[model samples]
Target: MPADAAAWHAWQAHQHQQRQRAAAQAAAARPSWTRRLRPAPPAPVRAATLVAALVAGLAFALLLGDGMGPGLALAALPAMAAAFTAARAAHRKARPWTLAWVAGCAALLVIPALRDSAWPSTLAILCTALLGALALHGSRTWPGVLLSPLGFADAAVSGIGWAWSGLHAVGRGSKERWLPVAKAAAVAVGLLLLFGTLFSSADAAFADLLGDLMPDISLVDGPLRIVLFLFGALVALTAARAAAAPLRWDRIEVAPGTPRSRIEWALPLILLNLLFAGFNAVQLAVLFGGYDKVLKSTHLTYAEYARQGFWQLLWATLLTLAVIALALRWAPRGKPGDRRFVRVVLGVLCALTLVVVASALRRMDLYVDAYGLTQLRVSVAAMELWLGLVIVLIVAAGVFGARWLPRAVVGSAAGAVLVFGLLSPDGMVAERNVARFEETGKIDLAYFQSLSADAVPALDRLPEPKRSCALRGINDELSAAGDTPWYATSLGEYRAREILRERPVTAPYEVCSRLGSFGSRIEY
Candidate 1:
């Protein structure tokens, strides 16, 4: 029985060898073209690359669209879509949360408020993509989440590396085979250009038609487009690849051989905290006291008073953040007393900084009230608010320790960006300024007219005469678009154009006093 079993095993092994030999011979027999020029990348890489390329193309096409805001919103679709396409390519099985993240991103894109503000729209798309990638890869680590952008950027480099590797894998002899084709193509292009130019120069009618057909490509813009396309493609590809294989943060935290003494870190923090406390006390007594108190303390007008310290306060908050980070880095974590004191100082510092944040926000509010909101003002306000939130989180970290601090900070910051983006700052600014005009019976017509399509919806809400005057520039530009193709249509531009069509501008004003590139062809 043992002899018979051994013979059977030997027969099976021989059969396996025969099959492998036959498969190898068949593979070799196949024509060179029948095989891939390079080994096909894994399914995920292929899918991600193709999807990213397509989306990037779409984004570029969208840039030629009518309104800056909607055009930007549409352009960000590639980044958002990459998260979904990459996840589908990588994992065979996906969680419900992954789907939710993708869905949430799609929902945000469609919301009118988010679609009309370029900055907010772009930020929201990035946040959504990052969140989606995280969910798909099952990465919840704070450090990794915070470093998502770097990972995405690295993925592009990795892809380029892969390309290099594939090229190296191709035999050197293969290059000779394609050399003739390359020469032929180059010769053909040169001959065509030479002949075409000569033919056009010899015949006036041909020259006229050729000149009409050719696009006016400037020396700068012609090269610039190609460069931008290549860069954008690389970025999109990297983002797609990163979604599939999320980078993990696993650095070993090495303790310093000789830690600095507590006094070195604590003394500065204590002094800084004391200074902040004094400032906060003053802010409470004067800044938050009352309009009358502010008026009495500073002889300057309300706007001037509000404007005085905002830039300074902003710089202080940023500098304080840097100081805290440096202090924590050097401060001894091993000693319980040292750690406790450090935490207390940080908490107090963050608390005081919040007061500074509040004062900055108050100043910005007062200034906006007096002068009316602008993109710069709104953006600064939102940024300061986010900073204040970060400070709160820092204080929480001091109390609770750092286990979830990184994730909380990243998530909160992302949330803040999304919230602000959804708020449609441009439209909000326009709406507020229009309301201010109604109250004060004065408006900054120049500023109002300067706003982009994000302000269109708000401008549409205004009563005539003011509305007509406000939209005069926009309407002229819209008219000068010369029947834009459907491919370049945008929500903001479409809405603005429709409003103008419905309510024709009766006010007399120079059409596009400062004509943009798109409107330059029209006889103004």
Candidate 2:
């Protein structure tokens, strides 16, 4: 009888081994892409994900509805914390630069809470998102910088599956432990209900206190709130999952362009360089010769010439950058002379392009002086300046080697954006225009009307009617916004409120209408 039992156990073990071997073979036969999905998270990670999701959901639903203010910062906290926690749990060591990127993202989220201008706030939010993607899955390669947006898209699309997996893991935990906890929770709820109802009925003050302590839940908005909660939860879960297993975008390889002979590459660039040189020579002559020379040559007013050719020159600068990129790709490297020739032609082209950039900037300066500074003018000038910086970086790479060029370019751009936001662009514009007004006794009252609350301090410097006219739109917007919750208040809005309260717009219409026709009218 004992022998028979041992024989039966042996037969079962052999069958089990055969089944396992078959399953392994089937898995190996599956497509390569199918194997790329990460394995299911462990129980501890699943539990942490669930908790983080709940926190994110509550934060988003409660704090994000008021406006773009401290609420944004508050809402981002849980997701950031969860991402860090997941990284630690997965035993992933974050690079030092990644922390800097995260810190930058955090600072960006605070920008909206400080400034009320649309462009600054918009840029801050957009930059924060891009930086977040970089912190999560960024690589050092140029391709990685270019492809960071796609990483975010991939995470968002996979977030639902990640959330479901987490929830399922939590649900599959031990029933016995949860059962007793559930029973205890039910009993506690019953006891609270019974005593709370009796106490409320016995004393009106108790009922009032209870009502004040409880959150007000509306039936009408319940569905919308639930959707918001789910969205936040999904976001948190996906971020945690992504941090645990980041996509290696730097590993992607790109084929270099076909190499060409020195003549093939050098001929076109040489002609392009000649064209650039000729244009730059004329620009330099006009620059040094003053508006009289421009008037004689172009038969146009100085401002007209400045405005007419500035946009074209900017486009030409951009195209030259692209041409340089293409030229470098096909540049000959077979001989030392070939390399030197490539350098001379490209270097000359770059130096000439710098002149074009300078000319474009000079033209914009003249235009601004003749007319007045506008948001568009300031923004374009900044862009042109950055493009010039990019060219300089390219030149440095040509001399010093280009291994660091990609990251340096990306870092410079991010720094430029941060500086732009911190500068308070709208306020700067207002200050410039105000100074111009004081000097020439000419202002654009209508243009001032379009500025945001960031310009409040500058506009306050204006006298009487001009001040009242420039501040009317901002005043109206603040008044319409009413008394927002503390979490939704911006520094710009708060200061504007205080200023307007102290010196309210008295006789706004009469003073504004009288002075409106006096300032310079901006055509575009």
Candidate 3:
């Protein structure tokens, strides 16, 4: 009986072994095996990262070390976007949401801080794209909830780094997370103050350094703008093509079959950044506050400034190119998170904006007597508030997000005004005036000229003495700085008060004048 039991156990063991062997053979015969989606890591290229960092440092020295504030600020947008894009791509299961976030950040940079625009179409696009990417990519945290508020967070009283860093912190939070932001803010402020101090000293020591080099050298052939514009165009094309490409699940971030050597990856980017940094440094040394420098010294009122603006634009284009080149290089060539298509579209849009804005900026300073009552009363800030808001909203809706936002904002603002008019004590007389200006530019003139009792009361309410005094100050400034010659012939009755009285006029006369460009004037 014991022998029979042992034999039965041996037979069972032999049967189990045969089954295992059959299973192994079946597994080996299977083709195109796949793993359930899992978290992955970026390639380990330590040397490339180090090289990129070194190159960025050199760029900081060449460009940002000088006393240019706005350039640095503008440059930070693309730079941060590039870094975010690269970092997000370094992962194996690359997130599409990260690309959306990057685009949103880029859009935010374009939103003029001084303008009163709504979240621009560009901003909306960025936000929507980012949100979509995040949604598709599946990250844990909402980045905009934390970062978007930074725009409004800027105020002198907000944080120590607010003055320097631009990102005003509300207060301290997770020390590990907040520490980098705080330090970055401090460094920015420190560098700005230091540059301002050094520039002040340099200007006093080397007067020639303050002058425009273009006039002296007559370096006419080296506009560099055409090259820049063309380069920008190419980048834009690349981005467009890439963005046009699809975002398939299979196309997500995965390991490269043959990884690039670190030095090889970084060399092009480092050198490009260095070139940009140097070019921008030269631009800073020459600019006189504005992109253009009006040189009255050469007996040249030829708006020597426009030339300067052209040069600045040229450099801006070059710097933009350098940044993109760096971004492409540092990007894991052929990696998953590398949204080559999305970036290409953005690059084109960026170039277009730069060209349009630079053209407008060049035309701005040419207006004659622009410092007078008209320009002062209707400030750029006021116009920008409405126009920028509208542009921003529309752009966001049409280009980046749902196309309904622009319609909603426009409808809302108009509806509010209409409702206010129906309920107002003034019976919407203000609307009448607004309409008249847009249509006829008469400005309630007939109503006032009829000697309406309300007109005189309204004029008196304006505090004429203070108004006249301010107008006089404006006149004096215009005389000294304006391009147009004041003409008594153009003045009408009430507008020609001081000049007519001539009663030992201690201040300048108040008279409406036209704007002009160069040696020309546009009389009304």
Best by the TM-score measure: 2
Best by lDDT: 2
Candidates, ranked, lDDT: 2, 1, 3
Query: CA lDDT of each candidate?
Result: 0.64, 0.77, 0.34
lDDT per residue as tens, model 1, 147-235: 54555555677666543332333222244444665699689989988999999989999987776544334565645556545665665
Error of 3 at 405 (Å): 28
lDDT of 3 by residue, 364-482 (tens): 33421121112221233222233334434434543565335523443333333223222221212323333434454333222222221111212222223322332342234334433
Badly placed stretches (over 4 Å) of model 1 are: 1-114, 122-148, 157-237, 243-249, 252-259, 287-289, 461-463, 482-490, 510-524
Error of 2 at 154 (Å): 2.2
Error of 3 at 287 (Å): 5.1
Which scores higher on lDDT, 2 or 3?
2
**Candidate 2 at residue 88, lDDT?**
83
Predictions: Cα RMSD each: 12.9, 6.8, 27.4
Predicted structure 3: lDDT? 0.34
Q: Give a tens-digit lDDT track for model 2, residues 1-524.
A: 45644564465456446645764576578765433332333223445555677789887776655567777888788888777887787777878768878888888887888888878778778877777777887567777777765766666666566566545544554555346766996899899989999999999999988865443457776776688787787778767767766666776667788889977888888898899889988877776887796698778887898899889988988998889888888989888888888888999999999999999999999999988888999989998999999999999998998887876787677777778777888888899989999999998787776778888999899997778888887888888888776667788888888899999876457677777733565564
